[model samples]
Target chain A: MRVPEVLLDVRDLRICYETSRGCVKAVDGVSLEVYAGETFCLVGETGCGKSTLALAIPRLLPPNARILSGSILFKGVDLLRVSDSKLQELRGKEIAMIFQNPMTSLNPVHRVGFQVAEVPVTHFKMSWREALATAVRQLGRVGIADPDLRSRDYPHTFSGGMKQRSMIAMMTTCKPSLLIADEPTTALDVTIQAQILKLLHELKNEYGLTLLLITHNFGIVAEVCDRVGVMYAGKIVEVADVTEVFEAPLHPYTKGLIDCVVARRKSKSRLNQIPGTPPSLLNPPTGCRFHPRCAYVTHECVKEEPRLIEVRKNHLVACHNYEKVGGVSWSS
Target chain B: MELLVVEDLRKYFEFKKGLFARKQYVRAVDGVSFSVERGTTLGVVGESGSGKTTLGLTILRLIEPTSGRILFNGSDVTRLSKEELKHFRRSTGIVFQDPYSSLNPRMRVKEILERPLKIHSDEGEESRVERIIKTLEEVGLSAEHLMRYPHELSGGQQQRVAIARAIILKPLLVVLDEPTSSLDVSVQAQILNLLLDLQSRHELTYVFITHDLLTAKHVSDFIMVMYLGKVVEYSTVREVFSNPRHPYTASLLSSIPIPDPKLRGRKRVSVVGEPPSPLNPPKGCRYHPRCPYAIDTCELREPELLEHDKKHFVACHRAGELSFREFLADMDSFLSE
Candidate 1:
């Protein structure tokens, strides 16, 4: 089988947020790629800049955020170099993003149907009536019962799952090629979360869309993601096939992270914690950001930044002690 | 030897629609019966509206139970008056979720931990300060943290302070409501380890409540699964996880991704649709509408929580007949399709 073609590629992306103190280096020289029609996940802890890197793809950075230098190559077009009008057109037509919490992302006062309808109306210049009709149909596709009636309901009237469904409907209305869902099921229950995951999978297949899923939940990454990218302090630490990464995690942070989840364990033992906290991006540690917290800290690891080196086929890890960090078997 | 026995406990809230309209009763915790053995952990797992929080609060008498007896050491807590409860507070402790909101933002850590000791015990100022420092040390903090405010500490530190306060009194029972849910995964593991350590040291019984099944399985000796204000399945952690008895339990277990790529294509029960409203819940089995193996009997009659084995309990009409493997197959097909 031939290697799949790359859809979105980021090269030397750096993002900084202006605060009262100084510039917080959120995304520091991060680079990764998303293949067409594949679910690629970026897993990291909170404030690790995975979300910032995601938002930067569609130029959805906040007012205080500044993109110092990067080229977001989407279908061979540098999204950063694209015109403002072109980026706006690119947002809903080719790339769309879902947030961690749809409660804040969605307009509470507006009817859910109107929000979904606005996507097509603004993107395709459809009439209000035509868009509403299309929005209702899309809502039904997401498994929200009584699409016509539920579409008329406001965000406040819907459950966490329903609100996410409406958001999914709005995002995928135009069949955007890349769907960036950031913690889509974090606020939802396990049962409802399964349904949402199923809906996302179904929609991904139906639209033949490449999905960039950002989440901290390893369970979600295993279930839906085709490939995985481990992000730590704004850098892509490891990138590999989901199975390869889970079975034999290369980076110390990746191994420590996968070992943290309770479900992934083979035996009942104390969870292996990544000691210390995620470093403050305002003034991160030199060499490797994760070296301070990593269990296997070497002299060079603390002095020299390890490049993302591929030790195995299709598996990349950024760790001076990648070979030392042995594979932990998850199969019990 | 049970430390606490909750017999057919019920807690309901009345909401009046209009000035003269009939007040609707929302049955939050309906006839839940369970026991907490001394020095053991009982985890209550459920969705947001599944009454897990309400059950915890009611156990602490934070909310008045509609009807039931809460026996603590053979003393009825529900019957305890306001004056008598002052002494009772020494025996029970309650730690809420969301440490940011739970800890008083204005108060210092020393003040927060001191108030419980002063109220529950007769410790002087010097002894109180010493006790505070000792308790903080137990939760992996130090004396320096006492001077800082809640905002000064990280999310994990604030939670440690919260846990410190809960155990300072050395209460026989501490009702911890989703203590680890809000923390980062790494921090969450530390907190879980701390709780287990504190439990062993203090000889405490914990009512660990959370929505995450994995966390629940890790910390709990006995797990009580709640649904729509009712106990659907209550059993040992091994039974609930390895061989779930109730349809809801099996569905919930399968729905959770096993966090292994090898188990990616594996089948899991596909439970769709939202849980029914607690206000006007279904007449018979509240879960029948969403339960895949729902039969006429499930809809017609409410199944009692029956004992399958010595410790395993399930409330399902077709618990014996409906093979659990079939449920896993249903979920596998749900994914394959």
Candidate 2:
């Protein structure tokens, strides 16, 4: 088998936020690699730092957040060392991100057409007329009927699904190699979510895009992701092929997360819940952040943090008792 | 015996564009009717703008219904006197979708749970504290949380506090409106399990309203599918899952991304286009514009909700004639392939 080229390589990235109480370690020494032309999903509960990691890839961390130590290599270029102009040149042209709420992301005062046209105009330096023309066609390409009329309307006139489509259209105007979608479909309805996800998959195929999808919903991961990384308390616990992640989850948190999704199977049995809440990032636990909630925690788990290690080819797990989690008796 | 019954409940809000402009009606809850058994849950499933929330609120008289009636234990809630309505409100409770907003951030957990008791009961301060502690324990919270404010608690704990407040009065029925939608998946499971445990222990009837079909199926005995302020399909959970008569229901079922990765490419019905504006909904079948199997009659004539099979109600022009079984079977075959 041919080895896939690495598109985005993140190494030992640590991110923290300055707060009144203390420094909140949002992403603590996490490392992962995304391959070209493949969908990599970072799945976790809220506040697990998946979104922060995604934002960190394109150097989009807010002012309050600081990168304690890390290197983000995109196409063999370390973004952290890049100059402001160089990073700005690479931002929307090569790396684009879509947030959870398109309503908030899109400017309410500007027409949808003008907002989309601004992308090509700013990045490629196209003329206003040419950019406007391109925007209409781009809107049509993203399944917006009558792009001419719809493009003239403001964000308020568009529905939630349409607003999302416009966001996708604007993001893909440059056809970036890497698209970081942070819970892109979390706000839409089920049917509309299906539509948006299908649109994303098609766009990925059309553009040969490498997708970094950050989501809490496993269903979306099952639908689109080629590989999966399960995050817990700002640390990655497991990374594996999508199929293996479901069929044979090595980490206890991964197992608990999969079992927690109320599956389609109609049964009265109770869902398997991870005991205790996630540790506050201000001052994490003594050792493993998940030891308090893990069902298979041992003395070793509490004393030291487990490192992500390759237990099998292309599959990794960070758990003291991963061997005990092998037997697949998944209720769902 | 039916514990709660809503008969043709309707809630319409009027919007006037100008002083002389005609007052247009936004039928938020056009007409919805359902009943719940004493110990069972009726899951009200729909997307946004489908009026499921309005229906829940109207049933509790939190949002007064413009028309129709709500009967609790054979007593008409709409006709109740001011004193009787106050008495009736104590037996019914509602937990909103967003716990962070539903809870008063200024109030501590003890005061939050105590507010309902102080208003509804004449118990002494000592007895109320005892009751508060017991109720907190029931929702898996402890005395430590009592003194903490809402912001100090996590999302799941805030929801548990909301649930505790809803049940502290020991109401016979509780309307859980998307209680777990805002929570993380693991925390969602914890809250769902807690709710089920509470229901069985207290014999409480729940009107569980949510947009998630999987959660609705998991917690509900009967499922009611809504679209544009109307019930498109209603049946026992088993019947709704196995033989969905309404095209919208079938589309909704097929649209859910089954968590199993193996079922990725399974056949599904993509209801083309989004739901039309509720202010000016489609003339005939509300779902006709998006229904894949929409026929000419579906656009010309509105269909009444009729019973197609024992205990299965569907509002569609071609409910019985359309073979959703064949469509669903095709999906099942592809899923198992």
Summed over model 1, clashes come to 1
Off by over 4 Å in 2: A264-266, B326-337
lDDT of 1 by residue, A254-286 (tens): 888777777654323567777777888889999
Worst lDDT 10-window in candidate 1 chain B: B328-337
- Per-residue lDDT of A1-332 in model 2, one digit per residue for the tens? 99999999999999999998989999998989999999999999889999899988888889999999989999999998899999999988899999999999999999999999999999999999999999999999998989999999999999999999999999999999999999999999999999999999999999999999999999889989999999998999999999999899999999888877777343556777888788899989977889988889899999999999999999999988899996445542
lDDT for A264 in candidate 2 is 39
- The candidate scoring highest on DockQ is 2
How accurate locally is residue A310 in candidate 1, as Cα lDDT from 0 to 100? 83
For each prediction in turn, the share of the native Cα contacts (below 8 Å between chains A and B) that it retains comes to 0.56, 0.67
DockQ of each candidate, alpha-carbon based: 0.50, 0.59
Supply candidate 2's per-residue lDDT for A240. Answer: 97
Residue A133 shift from truth in candidate 1, angstroms = 2.1
The candidate that wins on TM-score is: 2
